[model samples]
Target: MYLVGKFEHSVNAVQLSALLDITYKTAWRMLNKIRSVLSMESQQIWGEYIEVKHEIFNQQALLSDDRLQKERSVAIIKSVKRDENNCSSSFFAFQLLSRRKQAREVLEHSEQAEILIRLNLGGHSSVDMNPRFQQFQKRNTAGDLVNSGKRTCHPLSVIASNAFSWMKDKFHGIGDKYAQQYMDEYCLRLNASTGAITCAFEHTASLSLQMKH
Candidate 1:
């Protein structure tokens, strides 16, 4: 709890054990089991909106003669707030987007998503390009990415930024291996806006049940 509180984070094996006063290993096992349900295997493929996001990840490991490049994982999330007065009681729909041309092509082949998102709704997109990669040897914020904008940022950027903020606040930092699962679960939680805890809980429980059986 001490360590976690320092980071203003939640949903992790460390805190779970401390709260229950259980063994570290036992807590780890339990956390892993529950967290597994949130993994990619549980990602609901609705074929609903394509080109929203999650299109950025489709890279393959390259055979290296000598060159090793760093991999970048960028997911753009868009959301719409459900109002006090609306047809749908809750939810702000979000979409995962991609930037690589090849990624888009594969997405098109798989889901036929070109009309819904308008693909290039935001001008000067980061998708559809191949840049030389680099490797990191240490832990330090990339100065190149530290933005000092005048009026915060663009709308799409705001939405994308907000999604991650919500994820980190509610679920803590999602490690590389379990990120998708965490992401899926987080998306599910935010799907129903205006604080529908009951609905989110039921839906997540249903998902867990399905995964178990």
Candidate 2:
């Protein structure tokens, strides 16, 4: 629970092992179990006005084939809400995309009928895009396909950049297989409030009991 509360600061298995006087393997397993639980908790359907940005992570690719094998595609989703005072707040979620799926599934199955999608059409030419996503780009030629050059300093972008940097600095770098779990952990920490740690502790304890039974 302590380690999960400090997720925003980045905690690795090595550090947890040293702190708990346990083997690295045990610490790693414990950490991943927590991440897996958080990932399950993050699967809620999002509605209302949401912004989706497709980004390529891990390695830079100069060619299409290299991108398919070496890089990972992720959708950074930001859902905005307003209070009675008209102050805006945002919550974020991430979905790792496979080469065959791309953002087509996300667009097609969205709960909202009119969603505002903002694509960062910068260095993503090498990505193996879904045919439907390509058609979406072609159909929405009225300024929906945003150029990366006109980027603004949005909070969502900052959170995404920080997540990459945190993983690099702490875990050195994560593989594509476990990337979604790490992203889930990051989003959990980002969206957590003051009482969130207590809630996490209760939830973890419940899960532990269920597993034992």
Candidate 3:
């Protein structure tokens, strides 16, 4: 649910089964079970600064054999704004940091200002895109996309793709419930690409020490 769900596209049990290398019947049974479990309410974790990307795959895409698929995936780099930090930017910038200094300095505004404004005001969803979504896209976000804007290389899509690429590689496939788990891990990694991991480990160590005062 997380990867495709974050993108807000529905996946059938059969497709989930193939992706996860499980039986079709098993996938169908598990999907219902998991959805029932998740019917309870949930809270949203707002991303104060984000580089959100959305991709779409039609039904045919999901149903086709991997080698036979021909559907297109559109990656949107929506609201790539950054917050004045040591917090948001620390993670945002770290993700953008490159082999050279130029990459570090590039997209400074796009990351902090333009992207931020859009996410806060624009509101993106599946299928029909927000006008704001089109703004500062590959064409406008110069620093972020190399080889010119000829390619649609939005940050959100790029990061998500990399994460999914890893998941597909490691697990070969994911059942719907399991797919959701992997997606959660991906979101946490993306959202926590900064100090949360370190802060968490440090907190654990501090608790273990029983610090004096």
lDDT string for model 3 (30-84, tens) is 6554433332211122333334333331213235355224322322332232346
- Per-residue error for 210 in candidate 1, Å, reads 1.3
Give the candidate order by descending lDDT.
Answer: 2, 1, 3
The CA root-mean-square deviation of candidate 1, after full C-alpha superposition on the true structure, stands at 10.6
Q: Tens-digit lDDT track for model 1 on 1-213?
A: 122212333356666778889987898777566545543222233212222443223233573423222222444434232335742232233333433443323334323234233333333232222121212222324423333422223333444455566656665544446555545545555553434333554555565788768
Better of 1 and 2 by lDDT: 2
Whichever of 1 and 3 has more lDDT, that candidate is 1
Each prediction's TM-score versus the true structure: 0.46, 0.63, 0.37
After superposition on all CA atoms, what RMSD does each candidate show versus the true structure? Answer: 10.6, 8.9, 14.1
Local accuracy of candidate 2 as per-residue lDDT tens digits, 1-213: 656755457578998999899999999998998777655542222323556665555645355654546766566776555557776555566777655543233334332222222233222222222212221231233544465333344445566678877777778899988898888777766655422233445555555565658
Better of 1 and 2 by TM-score: 2
> After superposition, which runs of candidate 1 have C-alpha atoms over 4 Å from their true positions?
1-9, 39-71, 74-86, 89-156, 163-174, 194-198
Ranking by TM-score: 2, 1, 3
lDDT (Cα atoms) of all candidates against the true structure: 0.42, 0.58, 0.39
